[model samples]
Target chain A: MLIRELERLENLLQPWREFEYINREVFRTLSPVQVEFPLVNLWKNEDKVVVTTEMPGVESEGVEINVTGKTITLRFERKPEELKDGEAYTRRERRYGEFKRTIELPFNVQSDKVEAKFSKGILYIELPRAEAEKPRKITVKSE
Target chain B: MAETVKDKNRENRKIYAPAVDIIETTNNILLFADMPGVNEKTVDVTVEKNLLTIHGMIEPTIDDKLTLVFSEYGSGDYQRVFSLTDEIDKNNIKATVRNGVLKLVLPKTEKIKTRKIEVSGEA
Candidate 1:
């Protein structure tokens, strides 16, 4: 009974025995396999809300952008390569799949007048604010 | 048994080479793998006997009728093998995938030396 308890204790304590070296090895082996993708950023301006995302290596037509009222959605698909028979891959790390991301805006936006542009793997979305939503300046009179 | 282990290790090492980035901080080590389109269902990450392996399959999404205008990222299967030494708390390793980025947090082992002390004596 005591031996079994000791074994269980050892098992529980195993992960804490060697963390530094494992971390170093994990970092050392990561450089060649690292993949970087685009991140989406949304900000509001005086007249519009700008959405920018890094999407390097994707075609403009392959991406679909849609907006409904206060919500915006994006969807895209990527294809994999064709391999010949009897040919084995040495190193394969790129990803090819479909993805979708949707974000909600603080205020209602005009979907019909929205503008989108893709250049150098970056997608820029400009959403014009409704006439009522734009900030208005009012003069204050001293009483 | 040792020879077989070595042979298997060599075979695994030769099969797929994945580029990896290991970011180390005070609390843990973050492993970021550029596995572009690998879904969570198909991806596998395992650690055994100090050896960590990440393997997954990436399928193409294009059709025959479509023509590609530009492509900077290639799509294919993903595989990476790593041999770890001491310094990892294997049991506490955590992994999460978001937006095609595989993030792994490897915490430092409690038994490993983490600090040094300086002793002073009166002359």
Candidate 2:
């Protein structure tokens, strides 16, 4: 009986160990990408799929959004001004240039009804499901 | 183990600029630089005599409407220079910046590829 409890405890800790191992591996793989940029989160609700991307220092007008089939593309470019030739720089660290990212949608999205909003350096995209793809309630009667 | 420890110590030594992480893959080399609050036009990347230099300037964030409650990230310009060896192809260095992340893709030159030749006795 005591051995059974120990086995149960080991089984509970196994998942935690696996989680730690996976987290460490991900960190090790991403260690070379030194820039700590904002993260993107995607979630699916009943009727719509939402995508939120954190893009600080980017203006709403600068971002270009395109949707084709089940894929969404985002493209933008940043251009900073030049400083005086005689001026000296102390510490400078900020990324500037064109960036493009494309994501595939899990389900078929209604291309015509897609909505995009940008606020506080965050871009939010809402993709509603087509009429045929949406879930419908069905009634069953016993024969 | 001792050599690895020494290498870690060497990497820890701070220079005047921020440390950059450069990752080399099969197709390109991704350059991740920590540059806070730097915009597009202020950033300059140039390669001269096999020396790659990344210069960035961060403008101060001063908004009258927004009230500052707490702040942790610092605001400063970033400058780092890397001496590139013959491993990187000089002609095909491409750079892109997005959301404060600078991605540089350095393509390898054809001359850098290894070639095996057959050895035969002279006829």
| DockQ for the candidates, in order | 0.03, 0.03
* lDDT by residue for model 1 (A51-135), tens: 7665534678999999998898988875544444432333344456786778777678999999998653457788888888888
| Model 1 spans with C-alpha error above 4 angstroms | A1-143, B1-18, B69-71, B116-123
TM-score to native of every candidate shown = 0.40, 0.41
Best by TM-score: 2
Error of 1 at B117 (Å): 5.4
Q: Write the per-residue lDDT of candidate 2 for residues B2-121, one digit (tens) a residue.
A: 989966764543222433445544444556565544556767898887667787765433433333322223334555667677777878888766655565667766675445689999
Candidate 2 — which residues are off by over 4 angstroms? A1-38, B1-123
Error of 2 at A7 (Å): 44
lDDT of 2 at B23: 50
Q: For the second chain of model 2, what is the TM-score against the true structure's chain B?
A: 0.66
